[model samples]
Target chain A: MKWIPIILIVGLLAPFSLNTHAEEKSSEWVKVKGMVCEVCAYGIRKSLMKEPEVQDVEVRIKEHKVKIVYKDPKKSLDRVKLAQILEDAGYALEGEKP
Target chain B: MLRLGFFILALLGTSQISVAHPVIFKGGIELQGETQKKDSAFSTTYTFSPYWAVAAQYYEMREPSMSPLGRTFEASTVQINHLLKRWWNEGSQGNIYLGAGAGVFAPQGLPSEFLARGEVNADWESTTLYVAARYIYLHPDFSEDVDFKKLRVGFAPYVLEQEGLNSWFILEWRQMNTEKAEVTPLLRFFFRSVLFELGSSLDGDFKFNFMIHY
Candidate 1:
């Protein structure tokens, strides 16, 4: 009978923890060089979307930036892999912002 | 007779200007087609890397009454395109490409010949403006050599976001070896990975081209 109270409390807190984790799934903004046209944006978007961790991608040609949403927030952004993807897409990664 | 053959060959070999990029992003595939009055060309390219691509091209020139020996000149070549240089500027991009190919050239009712091609192209473009130039040389084993030079300038009416439909108006000038030059005004539109062009030369010859990348 005593264990039932602890079980009830843990169940009550589980949803809150899951919500916090979901909120932590953050988006990243990356500055890209040579992303000047729609075609260039398409290439970058297509390449980034191939990564398993990337959930969504948006490219802004005017600002030369790419916004990436990750499927798993706990996984850190691999800058080396990001740079390789940009290089393969015929662009260069200038910097990143949180 | 030889002079007439040369003239007929030159007439059949009209402008070969393609508005498509020869080398695309890594693992990209591009298909392009262009057609005019006397000539039509189709090509497929695969880009293994950002800096290099391989393509197979088929070109045909047709004129029945003008040629004494043949009605059509057909060439099928395998080409390699190298991105020699690229510049990523603040609001624009520029690129230079060099390409070469060799294949069989066959004229109807005549023995097949060896054909070789060399080309250089350069382009610079921003969201609002674009300029490009190209030169191509064709050498066949048993015929006079042919060359083409082309220049183009274009402007967009309004700037649109990446996902929006984009349109541009362009003017093209082409000069073939020892032949009269032609001027064309073209409309270009692109949505996503598909691009198409429509134009008519000042001489009233129709032009159509399309490109798709995947």
Candidate 2:
């Protein structure tokens, strides 16, 4: 009866530990905003091509955002670098974290 | 006399009055001829559509080289047709409609013509043109030597498109009653809310047709 509490605690902590370790291994993603038309969406997709680790990039005009899926977990795409490229092309990028 | 009888036959076999309500009705004229002797003729139609429609037509012919009727003869007729396929829109252009209807005929228009005719037709559309092939059963009221069955084909092209303030061209072709073909080319003028056609057929036959639409 005393071991029951210990088993419950171990079962609950196991999932949290696995999740924390996965978060450590996988790079965090920040969806860049500001896409209103086909041209704006294509511009963001073109800028994403410079990142070698970017596995795929998709821009949703309805939500005005771009999702950058990356293959490498150790290295994340720099948002500041992407924001500068967007600024040069007459657009504002937001919700990006270093 | 044989020609007039056949015109009535075509009308009775084709005109069915199931869809004749007072508000919307469709009608038109089709005449065919070439040179001087007009060979064949048929048309005026109203369709409630695939479920219901009625059509009427006329046919006349005179061959001086074959029949002893000189070069002057005429047969005018009116027939009602019911469509085999129903509920099709009556005003849509470029659709071939197949149907059957029956109507009566009074054979007294042009002298030396006799016969009341009934017919069924395959009416179809080709781009801006409408064509029909009809099989007419003829019954002569007077005892004159005319054939019992007359096969006819008719064509009318480009019924729409107003060109240059109501001036447009129409081409019509028909083979009727006997095995003779007639081709008529006409120019239509729409003025004062009325349509008028001036043309000549292959047999040196010339005439004018007029109609008014409300």
Candidate number with greatest TM-score: 1
Report how far off residue A23 is in candidate 1 (Å).
15
Residue A13 miss distance in model 2 (angstroms): 51
User: In candidate 2 chain A, where is summed lDDT lowest over 10 consecutive residues?
Assistant: A31-40
> Per-residue CA lDDT of candidate 1, range B1-214, in tens?
4323423432332123568678888998877777888677777788899899887777777764433233667776778999999887667778999999987777777887898999999999887899999998778898666677889999989776558888999999987675678799999998888888999999998998888778
Write the residue-wise lDDT of candidate 1 on A1-98 in tens digits: 99999999999999998877654546888888766677788888999888888999998887878999998887535788898888888888885321
Deviation in Å, model 2, residue B186 alpha carbon = 2.0
The CA lDDT of each predicted structure is 0.79, 0.42
| Local error of candidate 2 at residue B139 (angstroms) | 1.8
Listed per candidate, the RMSD to the true structure in angstroms reads 8.6, 22.8
Off by over 4 Å in 1: A1-25, A95-98, B1-16, B64-71
Interface RMSD of 1: 1.4
Compute the DockQ of candidate 2.
0.01
Instruction: Quote the positional error of residue B144 for candidate 1 in Å.
Output: 1.4
What tens digits encode model 2's per-residue C-alpha lDDT throughout A1-98? 99999999999899988876544223343444433233334445555656687777765543445667778765555657766655433244565321
Candidate 1 - CAPRI tier?
acceptable
Top DockQ prediction, candidate number: 1
Share of native interface contacts recovered by each model: 0.55, 0.00
